[model samples]
Target: MLIALSFAVGGLLHHLGILRIDHLPPLHAHFRVPTFRLLPAAVFGLAAAWMLPGALARLRFGRAIALGYGTALAWTVLLAVSGDGLAAPFTHKEEYLAVLPAVGDDPSGWLAGFTEHLPGYPTHVRGHPPLPVLVVWALQALGLPGPLWAALLVVLVGCSAAVAITLTVRRLGGEDAARRALPYLALTPASVWIATSMDAFFAGVGAWGVALLVLGRKRWSRLLSGAGAGVLLGSLPYLSYGLVPYLLIPVVVAVMVRPSRLTVAAILAGAGSVTAAFAAGGFFWPDGVLATHAQWAADPGAARPYLYFLFANIAVLALVTGPAATAGLVGPIPARVRTVVAATLVAVAALDVSGVTRGEVERIWVPFAVWVSVAGGFAGGRAGGHAGDRRWLAAQVVTGLLLQGLVASPW
Candidate 1:
């Protein structure tokens, strides 16, 4: 559950980047087109999210690393075979545009650099991090062919992100909450687009960070969790700007609503680590901080559809999920929260359709989704709350899926 929350936050924070389907700038001037070698970089990230933690901390490092990488190798092999045969298509055309990349920009000779890999188009723009870049390279080493390699990486990452989300939901509210979100994350339009490529890796990392945040203030645990999350968070923007602030909003909001040493430390450590890494030029290469600012400075469309839709989506997801949730729980939450949340979502949809942010998808509304689930999780009452809760959750999930049907399908 903690992990799922992180993924949700990550998904939420970076929703902005998802809308920019038309043209995304290259990661930076120094970042050459990611060679096919980046394919492996994609899967290894998921491995870290899936495997690490208790075992790595307690068991032999070598064994843990080997086991994780070894399993990924197996999965890679499975996909390599299927991809060679054209396998399946699980994403939208807009996503294809992102993956296809513009023809000539791929001069890095990515195709030749990695063996079991895919040939990616030379991208003129920048988004996403090198976590994917390096993993892509590793996948190339696994004996996969070019064309299907990238797609394979995406599926693997999607699985990882899904896992993280599931765990986080379970952690926060319970199994019910996690189930409520599972279908949404896996089957949603935007999620499907992201699922077919290596985009899930970023979301997974963001989810882990959220898990740490929920762990709250426990000193050593807090420091380690926060530090690790920071490095990943800092590295994330490079991969995709949408991830940066998506998760941060709830974190910021929660912390502000009830400040705690743990929350504060988590925020500072994660953000600071990212800063330190960039300053040292480790996570970000060449231009470093200057390049980052330059890119942000150039972002004229920083706020599209504004913050309205995000709020709306969150409310919609919550209001319908579980009756217990609809009742607004015992805390400070009120019934009006749902009304306001729903209104915001409507406004966002109208804005997007009326020439604001086009191509709305699940990723764009992830934060809202997460909040709804969290609310659902908390909605379960003490003694006899199951009946109402189940009915409410069913209504929400069904309704949400139907709403998605109305929107452009990710398929």
Candidate 2:
């Protein structure tokens, strides 16, 4: 009973607090996150879900909460290695470069805030700031240390995703579908793109938030889940503006049409907090930020179109807001609501395909991709099939994870 209560309480706290912590830091802070990408964890996040649902499910409530928290922390460390510790893609480099000039002429000034800076650059942040920045910022009000912040990030950045993928796969596709889907993610180039780029974790937070909301069984659970999703989604643009289309577009459409109060509240709260944070950080809407980003991407390696990338994202928008999302719906939302989502998705797809999809920085589409991958798992589950095939598919995903873990960067 205690364990169940803790899960309920912790769920509420995690859901509510992520927004508070996620909002505290400056946008540029995330650009300097340390690289700690341990691709094995990404692989684990997908691969472990099959086992965990049972293991954690069977545990005492306290044990289950403890077990879940432990897993969350462990995963954060692995993903952290890939983010800020390494170099970033072209459009992404600018987020750091903008602030670089401001802090330039005196590298020590910036270093004062961080005792251990990334190697190579002179007073420069390697990639986007670690996902922990906002989490730490939330802790700052409580006087948490950097190392502790990093550890906390392991939970916020790591488990949010790991559990999300697990639940999404299980709920949508079932155990069989989840097992089948694991292998492909292990070797995808996009996964490589995601881990290496710093923005992936923030996007993961957003996705998990959505997943949590969907999985929540009670009204309070729904509220908390939505809150988590809101914080994660809102945090994305702060790390990389490129994620907006994927993160914001789908979320808006989903919320506009969804029947529940929790989902609506989560979106509103998270977005509102982020907006307040952005304004507080001085990145006013309709300001030089847009103009500056436009000019920066105009050069070589500019935001050119990637057919696969667009197709993948379009598929995600379709899956997330389309029939797949409908599958996640428990009670029926109004017909008008579903119609609006359908229309909005169509419009976004039109804009995305027409080469209007510019200013895309790094793998900004990752959050959406995460959504797509989960949606795929769901869609795969919904197909009229058998238990044997599902298990076979899951075995393949598990095998892929093992193989990818042995090789470089498991996406």
Estimated TM-score per prediction? 0.47, 0.49
lDDT per residue (tens digit) for residues 1-411 in model 2? 332342243335335653222111110012132223445655665554445445553565445445554554443344434443332231243333334443444433443432234333221133333223334344444566333343344335533453455444444434544433332222122343343344455556655654654567777777776776677666665554444455544454454436386567776797689768656554444443344344445433233334533543443332222232323233232333333334434545654665534323224444444443332223333442334323433443333233223333211
Per-model CA lDDT versus the true structure = 0.40, 0.41
Q: Using alpha carbons, what is the TM-score of model 1?
A: 0.47
- Candidate with top lDDT is 2
Which portions of model 1 miss their true places by more than 4 Å?
Answer: 1-138, 141-194, 197-200, 216-219, 250-356, 378-384, 396-411
Q: Give the Å shift of residue 83 in candidate 2.
A: 14
- Candidate 1 vs. truth: CA RMSD? 13.4
Q: Give the lowest summed-lDDT range of ten residues in model 1.
A: 22-31
Best by TM-score, which number? 2
